[model samples]
Structures are given as C-alpha cells and as structure tokens.
Target chain A: MDTVHYLLEGFGTALLPINILFAFIGVLIGTAVGVLPGIGPMSGVALLIPVTASMTGGMDPAAAATSSIILLAGVYYGAMYGGSTTSILLNTPGESSSVVTTLDGYQLARQGRAGSALAIAAIGSFCAGIVSLIGLALLAKPLSEVALKFGPAEYFSLMLLGLAAVSGLAGNSMTKAGIMTIFGLLLSTIGLDNVSGVARFTYNIPALYGGLEFLTVAVGLFALGEVFKTILHKESHDGNLAKVGKILPSKQELKESSGPIARGSLLGFFVGVLPGAGATLASFFSYIMEKKISKTPEKFGKGTIAGVAAPESANNAASGGAMIPLLTLGIPGSGTTAILMGALIMYNIQPGPLLFQDHPGVAWGLIASMFIGNVMLLILNMPLVKVFAKIIETPPKYLIPIIIAISVFGVYAVQVNTFDLILLIICGLAGYYLASNDFPLAPLVLGLVLGPMIENNMRRALTASNGDFMVFLEKPISLAFIVIAVLWIVIPFVLKLKGKKVLINEEA
Target chain B: MSKTFDRYASFIFFIVGMAFMIESGRISHSAYGSNVGPNVFPFLLGLILGLLSIKLFIETMKYQNERKEKEALDYKKFLIILVAAILYALLLEPLGYIISTFLFLLVGFQTIEKGGWVKTVLISASFSFGVYYLFAEVLKGTLPGLPAWFSS
Candidate 1:
C-alpha cells in the first residue's frame, strides 16, 4: 500500500481510545519530566518503560507495542515543548536541548514577555513537529527500502559509523567517550554468544547469562545517577520565577517568528536525520543561523521573539528527525533514541528495514500518534503552562526521594528480581561517578544497545566471507560507510589539533 | 577533572580489558560452521579498550593538577539515603512492596531534609500503597505483597 493508505490505517490505530490516552499520559508525564530539573527525556522514558509494560499487559503484543511507543514518543517531543517553559521563566534549561532557548527565552521573560515567548515556543514546537512528521512520512518508505538491500557487510559498517559518530561528538574528551563506548561493548559481551550458544563471560552466574538488563542499567545511569547528583549537590531552586503575563502573542510577534520557525524546522530535521548530531546541536545551529540571517542581530539574546522561536522549533524538529535513522536503518542517533530502540527491542519488534514491512501497524501508528501528541502538547501548554511552571518549584526534598522510590519500583516491576535491584543501585553509583568525571553515559548506553547487533552482523559478514577481514572494504557501500566512520572520529581529532573548537552534543 | 580519579579509572579499566582478553581465550576458538569464533569480537574489543585506557593514562600524566574549588557535598545525607536505598532493596522482597517502599521513602524524605514528618509519612504511605494497589490490584501485575506471616 501507499504511504497515505498506511498512514490512514495508522491514524485508525492511534486514534483508538487507549492509544490516544497513552499519548496524552505520555506527553503529560513528558512535560513534567521536562519541567523538572533532575530528570531528562532519557530517564523519563526509561523510567516509564516498565510501567507502560505492565499497563499494557492485557493487550495483544502488537497493540501493546503501539500504545507503549505512542506514550514514549509523546514523552520525547513533549519534553522539547516543556523544556522551553523552564528556560524562559527560570533561565535554567529543563533539559539540555532547551539550553539555547534560555539565551532569548529568559531575556523575553525578563522583559515581561514571558507569555508570548512560551506561546511562540509552543507554536514553533507544534509546527516543527508537524513538519518533521511529514518529513518522516515522506522519507520512511524510501529510506527503509534502500536499507533493505544492504548486505551484512554493509549493515556492519553502517552500525560502526553510527557508533563512531556518537562517540566522536559525545563529550569534552573524545578519548573518554570512545572508552565508554568500548566498555559498554565489552559489557554486552558478557552474555551467551548468540551464534555459538556458548557462554562467553557469564561464568555460570544465572543472571549473567541473560546479560545485564538494559532497563535496569538505563534507569540507574540516567535516573538514579541524576538523583545522586541532586542529593550530593543539594540543589535548590531559589531564583525568582518571571511573571507570565498575557498568554497569547501579538500578531506582529507571530509574524516575525514564521520565517525562523520554518527555517529552524528544515535545518533541525536534517541535523536530526544524521547520526550523532541531536536536538541539542540542532537548537544551537538554528540559533546561530538565525543570528547570522537576522536583520536585527543585536535583538538576539535580548528577548527577540525569533530567538525563542528558532531554537525551540529546531530542537523539536530534530527529535522527529532522529526517529528516521532509528525506524528505517535500525541505527539510533542519540541516547534517547537508543533507549527508545531498546524499548522496541523489548517488545520483540526490531526497528530496521523490515520493521516497516513486518510491523506497519507499529511504525505508522507511532507516526500518527506523534501528530496527535503534538496537538495535545500545544493545547496543554497554551493554557496550563503556569501549572507546569509551578513544577519547577517542587522541592528537591520530596522530589528526589520519590524519584528513588519510583526507580526501585519500576526496575523491580519489570525484572522481578532482587539481583537487578542491587545492580540498579550499583549502576547508579557508577553512573554518578562516571558522569561527574566527564565520562559521557550516552555512548555507553548506545554501545550497549547496539553491541549485540554489531557483533552479530560482523560475524554474519565474516562467515559469509570465510573470515576475510577485507570483505568490509570489498563492498562499495560498506567501504563508504567505513570511510565515513573513520572520518567521523578522525576529523574531530584533527580539528582539535588545529585548535578549532568542535561542537559537541551535550544532550546526547 | 580529577586527576586522581582518571588515573585510577584508567588503571581499573586497563585491568578489566586485560581480564576480558585473557578470559575470552577460554571460549572455544571456532563456531561449528563459521570461520569466525565467538571469542573474536570480545578479544578485539578488549584489546582496543586496553590500548585506549593506556592512552587515557598517558594523557592524564601530561596534565598539571589544577585544584578546582570544591563545592561542599552533602556526604552525610547522601550516605544515609544510599544506605537506606540498599537496605530498601534488600528488604523489598522480605518485607513486601508496601512496607519496604514506605520505609525507604520515609527514610529518604527525612534524610534529605529534617522537617515535614507528617507530610513525609502521608506521601510515603500513599505512594507505597497507591503503587501496590495500582499495579498488583488494578493492573494485575505481580509484585511481592505482604510477607507470608503478616498476610496470613
């Protein structure tokens, strides 16, 4: 069937009462997750996986997957909208992607235009979401069809490129990021070897045979790790909240932002489609681009409506763009997408070229739900933004502990094992120390999620080639992928050697 | 960062890599039909990790230790909450979800800040009971309920 026909079917599924409710709840929690400082989109989505799992327990596997993903994707983009709320009002970004928004968002809020800034952000985000969804719809079939022709060799190389891209842009130090990636890959090797059915690193430990649980590790690293940071640092929000006056923007204000939103959506969508570059980078790039093209550049960082409009739109669009690589190529470009891929895998639904053909219901349903979820976010944020703003004032005292409780509950509910709970705590400690020391956690998670697939594909390719290592170079597509992967890692290092600053994706 | 932390982490990672490389040899060198073996992937990864750790160590050696202005961490509070979490995990299956969760939250709330005893109790009770009822009762998912003796 054509894309339009499949999309209509997807809308039928998405608009189902349960799926719509899932989207609503997902975006609601997502906005809350974004508004709160301690948790990010990664942790927010991770924490909810098990809860959503149980919530959809009674449904058929296919229906369950659709509903759960609808909610999770809602959280992902809903966060992009909610993040701007804090940036504009508190000058503290709710999530890293919103960091650029604070440049002009806070300035606008200071100028008593907080309401307009927020409204524009919501509008920009809504427009960007629709644009990217349209992009995803147009690109999904073509991209997956191309990916379907890839041999094992090409697949291996492409995945390697994905890993390399993530590690290259992950943190302040590429070496550290590379190490974390390798470490995660090593950790993934602990389970039973899929090909040989031989235990490699299990050492007869029963739990080890299944490998480390991804959900446990994720929650510990992102959720508990952030919690530990809050506890140790004793973070307190003492900044006076900027008063939000006039909920709607003036027509002139809206008119000024139209071009910026459109441009930001296009730029952000392209950036998001590329592996490694994420919403954080997209927002930064769009902001810079807007500044360069703006007739009144001086108005930027001083409450320019375009300033709030561009980056906010860009980040949301970038998130939508990131989904393309994941759904079509089975390569997650960012940390959050990696977690989302893990969730998909948990449902026994692999996200790759075959995903569109095998699970059209899931693929199209998710795309459709994003459209519905974006509307919900725009509607929710427009009137109830003040309620969300109050969430920033939630004392860390109550917030921190409850987060701990939820983490414990979520992990236990899913794994149903004491070992996982213990491991969760240990990972939490490890996550805190590693993150504080500038060891990026995203690459590690990405590596862990992609590790098995990379190894399996490598083995398959080598098996096909009778162990010839040069097979990767023999295939033109594979050779190109490998070259790009090498360039991805090496170019950054070269630029650093020349004292040129390479933009890093801190949100990843 | 911390120079000492990096130095230690690199050293530790080096050991982990070496251990993986050495232990991978225990796995059979070949899978029945494939020319490649299960051990190949981990072995290569371990070797690369070891080399990277060495690189990291050497890089750390070149840095002059700049003492950063350290912020006072709430060690006592953190340690207390951490210990409570550990205990909570340990006692979860034994004491049941509600009791263990309630106790953990109560401890966690008080440890983070001293006041709000009554509010803490209410929240802890509501959350623990609420989740248990919602999950076990409402959703029909399995979670350890009250201990056998207490329930009986």
Candidate 2:
C-alpha cells in the first residue's frame, strides 16, 4: 500500500509535460543506438551526457533527473530491442546480454523467421520491463536498508564473490577466468589513490592522475577491437538476410515464450538488486536456467523462442532491478549504474538512505520516468526496427573513424586537457589487451567506482573497532555476506569436481 | 605459453606499480588509519600482481600441449588505426576542436576504408559539426575553439 502511494506520487511527477517529452526522446535515441552494433548503453549515455546536461535548465532539477533516468532506461531497453536484430540477421550480439538471443535468433533468421524472432524479443522485453518495474517499486526501499548495513569488508567480500561467480559461470576455463579477473583488479588499482588523495601511477604525466576512464576502455575493447578483428574477413552469406516474416509471433511461439519470460523477469530482478551484478550476467544466467529446465533442451540454440525470450527478458528486468540498489542505497549493482551514480553526484544529488526523505521528488520522479520510458521504448522499437536494421548494414569504415574521433574529442572536451587524451589512449591500449584475453571488463570498472568506498569504509570500520577485525563478523549483515562469499567459492569447486562428467558432456 | 609474454606483462606492471608506490609513499597522507599510509594499497596491489605473474608463468609451463600456432600478429590495419589515433591526439591541441576533429576523421576514414573518399569527407564533416554544435552551442559547454570561421 505504501509502495502504491509512493509510485502514484512518482507517476504524478512523470506525467508532467517536460518529463514525458524527455522520456520520449530518451527512448527514441536509445532505440537508435541500441539497434546499432558496437554501441552499448554506457557509450550511448556518455555520448549524450553533454547533450542531456544542456537540458538541465529547461525543467526543474527533479524533473530533469527523471529525463536523464528515462533516457538511460530507454537506452537500456533500446539496446535490448536492437540486440536481437544483429543476432538474428548477422549472427553477432551488440552487447553481452544479447548473446543468448544470437543462438536461437540467428537460427530463426536462417529458418526465415527473422520477423517473428524480433517480435518475440520485443514482446518478451516489454513483459520483463513491467514485471521488473513492479518488483523495483516494491523491493527498492527494503533492499536499500539492507544495503545500508554493509561495511567495507562486506563490500569487498561482495566484490570477491562477484569475481568468483563470474569466473565460475563464464564460458571458459576457471583458471582463465581467475586470471582475467585479477588482471581487471590490477587495472582498477591504477591512477591516484581514492582514500589517501595521493597520485599513484601518473608517471609524471598530469593526465594519468585520474586513472583510466572506463568509457575509453569499454569503447576501445568492444567497439574498435571488434572492427579491427573483423575488417578483413568477408562473411560469406547465401542470401539477403531472411526478409521480415510475420511481424507478430505465432500462437505457438507465444505459448513457448510465456514461461521463460516470467522466470527470466524474476531472476533478472534478483540479480539486478545484488551489488556487483548486472543485466549481462542476468541474461546469461536466465539462458542457462531455461536450458536446464526445458523439456526439449536439444532444441535450444536452434530457433527455440524460449531461448531468445529468457535472456532478453532477464537482461531488461535486470536493468530495472539494478536501479533499486543504486537509488535506495548508494551502492551500484552494476558498472552502468556506477556511471549513473557518477552522473548523480555530478548533479550534487547524493543517493543514500536519506535520498528518499531529502528529495522524494528526484527519487520518485526518476522511478516514474522509468515506467513511462519502458512503454515509450516498446512503442518506438517494435514497429521501426527495419530502420534500425538499415543502421546495422552501415559500413564500418565510416563508423569506426568517427567513433575514434568522438572518443578523443569527448575526453578532451571535458577539461581541454591534452594530458587526458594521452590517458584515454593508454586506457584504450589496456582495453585492447583485456579484450584479446577474454577478461570480464565489468569487475575492473566496478572496482574503480567502489574501491574508494571500500577503502574508506574499511578505515572507518577499523577506527570504530580500534583495529579489531571482528567488527565484520559482529555485524549480522556483514557476516551473512561473508558466509555467502565462502559458499560462492566452495560450491563452485565442489560442483565442478562432482560434475566433471556433466561438464565434459556440455562441452562436447 | 611463452615465458616471454608472462615476463613482459609482469615486468611492465611491476615497474609501473613500483613507480606509483614510490610516488604515493612520498605523499603526506595515510592509507587506512594513523599507521597505514596511502602507498599501502598500491604497494600491496603491485606485490600481488608480481606474485600472480610468477604463478601464471608456472601454469603456462605446465601446458606443454603443442596447440596450433597462431598467425603472425596483424600490424597493418592496427598500425593505420594507431597512427590515426595518435595524430588525432597530437593535433587536438593546436587546431582546436572542430577543425582538428574534422580533418582527423577525414584522414582516418580514408586511411582505413581506403576508397570511400566522398562519403568519408561528408560524414566526417557532419559528425564533427554536429558534435561541436551540440556540445558547444546547445549544451553551452566550454568547447575549445580557434576562430569563428571553424564554426561553419
């Protein structure tokens, strides 16, 4: 009942003309970028930040915040909507969250059901969006309180658990996953110290003081690196990518997808609310879960609608779910949310236990905008997908160089610092290395954002405890997280040893 | 699987980390509490990285299986992209934002794409101008500039 009242308040703010307009614009641009390969929500937001900042004065600060949140949410869904297009048409996923879609989506394209594949993906995402939003509305406050009780050790332990889970679940050797995670941690340690306020690895260059920007690393590794690797290969195809089939899913497809969509929404919301996790992992887990449960598991990765529906829905739901932690507590559940946190801080609106009480307008207004934005995304993306498809066919030659120019200029524009440009290049090089080695970039990014918080919390905790380490164990919430962390490592190892035969079978 | 690669990564990172530790150690701030200093985290992180490299070395040695050797690293397209990026980085200061970006994008597109001169030029110009107008005029960002002529 309280949730209903708060949400109604949020809706009242969202219904304002300016908020609605921004929500529409956010979904519009989000769909456009989401449809294109090599662009993710992070880049979309980074590219538009300067633009979004321009609109700050036109609306109230609270309303303007809703616009930004709506835009980001739009990008999130737009990316989900557009993700399957490439997977079905080109056998490529625009983002990691879309990888599952590529399996059945590509197969569906091969079977000349491209239109049906896309329609189902869109529909699944819409369902997930609504369900996740409801979950967010209900769970955000309670979870925030839970998040508030965590100290530095608990946060670091949570990160450790995240790294382990990523390695355990990543589609590679455990040793390889461990190495990649460690490598990311090392990367995060670069630049000035967050707690000590001392420069660490600037190498006498002033620009390095800020450390490597995640945007530079992400864009270089995912977008530019992809172009570099694929430039020479001529992907031989048999025909014009399967022409749009029926624009709506068949009754059979709908029946197949309904169950996966529901399960995915629930799973995605839970993952999103957990700190250090995000939509990418949610989608991956949803696909694996669906595959594990399906009666006709063999049909997976071969045009099964459920295979596409599960992950697509999960990823979208996770996007909303992640906001729960970020808004209620100051903790970010994922890397994208971490960036959003940075944006919020830039606006001087600190999000924490008091955020709701201090600024209900910003909190509820942003929440309301997300609800409206999801509808905007569904309406905008489902019909105009062909236009986005055309964007996919755009030659890389034109896009790649422009991307480079923008990245170089964008970093420079922030401060007119020649040194920052150098730092960006160095980060780009590091990104290229990490990508070539199949390291998960998200952990390193999250570490960069959370490192200071963890460090400060540790200092504060120790000061309160007078050097006693037992403070971590004394707190029920922290102890619970520690137990979870311990189980995270042990469960995976035990499962691996016991299921060696199962692993072999899956590999084959 | 080569010692060379592991050694190379470790050696580079170790040197970088040590340099950071030394610099931060000289700073007047503490790291954790009154006893712990700011250099503690960097030094610890560096030490762990060094140890991890040694472990990586041992693991690489255990993989004696003669996997298929990879092709020589392609440095052609990579070089073009790198050079273009370097040029953009270098030229960004003197020429200001719009003109420098437009010229850089033009050359970079042609160098990489090879034959799309007209499309590259137009697209490059439009992209630079659009970013400039959006950031500078619309956003009121203090975008660096030379003269008003570069605006067109």
Candidate 3:
C-alpha cells in the first residue's frame, strides 16, 4: 500500500535511538504496574507523564509529543503482557479486559503449565501486534474513508451495536450486560447536559459538574476493585510454583495456535473498530470464533494453547484497530482510546478528519511507534515474567494501600481537586460491588467517555434534519448499524434457547 | 451461593432503576412541558433497565432451582477489606498522604493479612516512601505534605 511508505517515515522517527529507549522504558514500567494488579494504563501514564514532561527539556514540541505518545502506547501493550501474568498466576485480572484470560489461564497454571501459558501469551501477543501494525499501516487510510462516510445516525447505531455486543462478555448474562450498559449511560449523565446546560445528576458538587473522572473509574474498577475483592476473599494462593515445565510451545501447540491467532486478529480488529466496543469485546468474539472453528472443540477451557492465543491475539490486534476511528474521525472506539484523545488535547493536537492534512507528523508518528512499541513490549515482557508474577503474589496487606494512595495522588495531580479524591473512593467501592456479581465495567467506562459525543451528535443530527424523527433511520450506514445492534440483542437469546451451546466443551 | 448473589443483585438493580426513572420523571416536568428534556433518554433507559433487571432476577432463580445451593460465602473476610477501603478514604485527608498511607498498609497487612510486625513495617514504610518519591519528586504530582516533625 502507498500508505506503508508514510509509516516508514513514522518508523524512522520512532526508531531514533532516544525514542526507542523511551518506548522500551514505557513498556517496562507499564508491565511492572500491570503486574501489580488493578493498576491500568491510565493511572500508569498519568503518574509517568509528569516525569516525561519534565525530562523532555530541549526537544521540539512535536518530537516531545511523539515520544510521550510512543511511551503511552508502550504502557498500553505492556499492561496487556503484565495483566496476563497475574490472570494466569493468581486468578486476579489486572484489568477488566484481562478477565477472560483468567478463565483458562489460571486453570493452566493449576495444571502445572504456568510457564507455557506465560510463553504463549507473550508469543501470541507478539504475532498479533506485528500483524495488526501491518494492518494499520496498510488499512488506516481506507478505513478512515469508511469512517468519514458515517453520519451521526450511523455513529449512534454503531454505539448501540457496541452496547448490545456486551451480552456475550464471558461469564455475564445478557440481562446483566444490558443493565450494566444502562448504568454506564446513567453515569455519563452526571455532568452537565450538553444541550440545555442543566445539571442532570451533579447533586451540587462541582466535581460532578465535569462528571465522573475516567482515570478514577478505571483505577478504582481495575485496581481498587481487585483490592476489595482480594480482601473479601481473604484467600491467598499457596505458591505451588508449578515446576519449570516446558516454556516453549510444543510443535503441535504451535500449529494449533497459528490458526487461532490469525483468525482472532482479523475478527478482533473489526470488532475493535466498532464505536464503544473495545478489546474486551474483541477478546470475547475471538474466543467464540476459535471454539466455532476448532476441530477438537472440547479442549478450549482446559489450558488449551489455542484458547489463550485467540483472545490474547485479538486484544492486541484490537488495540491497533481501536485507533482507527479515533484518528480518522473524532470518534473514540474504546475507553483507552478516549483517554488517548484526552492526552492529544493536553498536547494541543486535535485528531479528526483533517488531522492528516493539519498534523501528519502526530498521526503517522503514533502509528509508526505502535510497531516499535510492540516489539519493545515483547522483549520487555518475556524476561520479566517470573519476576512480575512474584509481585502478584505480594500480599494485599502492603500492596492495596500503596496503590490507593498513588491513585489518590494521581487524581489530585491532574486538577488538584480534593473532591475528586473522595469521588475516586466512592466510585471505586461502587465499581467493586458491581464487578463482584458480574457487572462488566467496560460499558460504564465506555458510556462515560462517549456519552457526551453521542448526545451532542444526536442533537446535531436532529437539528440538521429539522426535527425529522426518522433521520437516524434515513442514513444507509446508520441503518445498517442499527440492524446489527438489533441482531446482537436478538441472536444471542435465540441461540441460548435453542440450547445451541456456543461455548466450546473444554477438556477437564 | 452464586445464584443468590445473582438474584439479589438483580433485584436491587430493578428497584434502583425504577427509582431513577421516577426521579427523572419528577425533575423532567418542565422538559415535558417543552415536549422533550435532558431526562428523556435517561428516563426511558431506566425503565428498560428496570424491566430487564426483573427478568434477570427471575432467570437467576430458575438457575438456582436447577442447580445445587452454593457453599456459604465468606462475608467476614470481604467485610474487612471493605472497612479498610472506607477507612483509607476517611483518613486520607486528615492524616496526610504519607503517614495515612503507611498506617493503612500496616493495619491491612497486620490485621487483615496477619503478617508479622517487622514484615509489615518494612513493607509499609517502603511503599509509602516509594509512592511519595514517585509522585511528588519524580512525577511532580502534588501530594499532601506531612507535619514539620515528620518531614525532617
């Protein structure tokens, strides 16, 4: 593709020795934070941003911004690698996105295959990351064109489809998913109502006027929630330290994983590009795809290499895919990308349709750095797997307090609001309970992030159409997405009632 | 145990969602006069969520009827963690970041984890100082300072 040439320019900038080193450091720190369980990319980046900003002294603002972007990407992927280690070793998922990894990952660890599990996760992620980066290089421009064609109705329908797709999140019932999605929309309403400027649910708090903080919700749900859950269970794993079994995949395992990884990457990327759907959905769909296609379908949840490869590959690929909408349009496809959007704003760079013409360096540099950052993550993760897993075993007694304190400090640093600190705790507790009974946190995060955009766009569409009620249905792309959303809700119920168990029968 | 948790949670969701719809309805009176208001979408969403929650509660009961009752939950342990979180939030402002954080870790480790004093103290102290340095010094994040006696 002609666009690949542009990516090469980006690669040149990203490969500069200084940029490479920063990318490596970002991945290393991201992995360490991820291993701690509950510390997500947002908090990870927020804490690190201060240091990066201070140290980038003499670099041009553009190059400095690129460095930070590369660093952030490193943390994003590095967290993925770190998240899996904890999920596999301790059954505690570091992020909501890693929840599915825990189902088979910890089971494999219990079966004395922790080394193999960790190795496959790293290797699978590498393969997926490389392929997705290539896909991004080749596909971004065309995909952006596809994105530009979408009208407000289409965007709204796409979000609805994304919301409905949550019904299939592993372990959550359809109704619970529905309720969770609604809960997210409600949280999104806490700030000012964009059209009227009337406060919907602020209850007089000024912090509430800006609405729920994304970092607060993310840190609380992933990290504090984990802490609360850990304390509740009051259970600790007796370190059996699974005997150093084979770390490398067997030939058969390698053959098995290749098909799953390839398919998962494609499936995950498309799903990731959907508005509001994210890596979590991509992981779910990828797992379902593997089970659907597997010849020996019964080996799925029983420490199967294919099972791990599918979701792991999908999520990494989806990370690349999620960037498409955010970069091409002003639309954010996932919670993480929403945060990335905020970072772009802080750097005074606007990412939208004209971004390519306005600031090609920022766009291309970000895409190019993803490729280098993935490699950096792979190298950073493998050697540190054992050491990282040890941190997971660190007792919560000491761990939780430190994380909570950091979370508080991190929030306070952003706007220096004491109220946000309090809000963080309240939201964290609510998130903890919601997660405990299987209310997936992703939708809430997604809704809160995308809520304003959805509302603003809908109003614009309505006004543009002169109060035509059917304008949402009038656009072709919009209608297609609405139909897809309807199918997402309807199809699953039909499948469940027919006893068409889509879940692969795993070997016990 | 799983079914009980599922059912109870859904029932609570049902009630809260209903409450939200009613509350939105009450506040949306003026918007209703204007034919639409800020609360319109939320009101409808709340109603949909309420209905779904009730349906899910029923489904959870059905599942429970089909399966065996789960073992009793270990609520005692969960309560300790909950209390610790509540305490951390309460004390963070009054006690200052470093001192409160160190004490919070000590209590959680010593009481909840039942770790030894030496282990608890060392871990707690290191963690408090590590975060303080990372955020305050390295990252330039604004953190609450300790009393004059403690800073020296």
TM-score of each prediction:
0.99, 0.86, 0.80
Instruction: Give the fraction of native contacts in model 1.
Output: 0.92
Q: Candidate 2: where is the Cα deviation over 4 Å?
A: A45-47, A50-66, A150-239, A274-281, A284-302, A349-354, A493-508, B1-7, B17-24, B29-36, B64-74, B147-152
- Which digits, one per residue and each the tens of the lDDT, describe model 2 over residues A399-453? 6677777677656655466766665666666655654554444445555555555
How many clashing pairs in candidate 1? 0
- Share of the reference A-B contacts seen in candidate 3: 0.47
Please write out the lDDT profile of model 2 over residues B1-152, one tens digit for every residue: 44455446555655654555565466655544555555555555556555655565565575556655675665676677777777778777677777888888877777666886787778877888888887778777766666555657
* Cα RMSD to the true fold for all candidates: 0.8, 4.2, 5.2
Relative to the true structure, candidate 3 has a C-alpha RMSD (angstroms) of 5.2
Q: Which 10 consecutive positions of candidate 2 chain B have the poorest summed lDDT?
A: B1-10
Report the Cα lDDT for residue A405, model 1.
92
For A222-310, candidate 3 gives per-residue lDDT tens digits of: 55665666666554655544443557667877787888888888887776766556677678778887888888788778878777888
* Per-structure clash totals for the candidates: 0, 2, 5
Segments in model 3 whose C-alpha atoms lie over 4 Å from true places:
A12-22, A30-69, A82-121, A167-171, A243-315, A325-362, A381-386, A389-393, A502-508, B1-39, B57-63, B66-81, B147-152
Model 1 chain A poorest ten-residue lDDT run:
A231-240
Q: What are the candidates' individual DockQ scores?
A: 0.90, 0.43, 0.37
TM-score of 2: 0.86
Better of 1 and 2 by DockQ: 1
lDDT of 2 at B138: 78
Q: What is the model-wide C-alpha lDDT for candidate 2?
A: 0.67
Candidate 2's fnat?
0.35
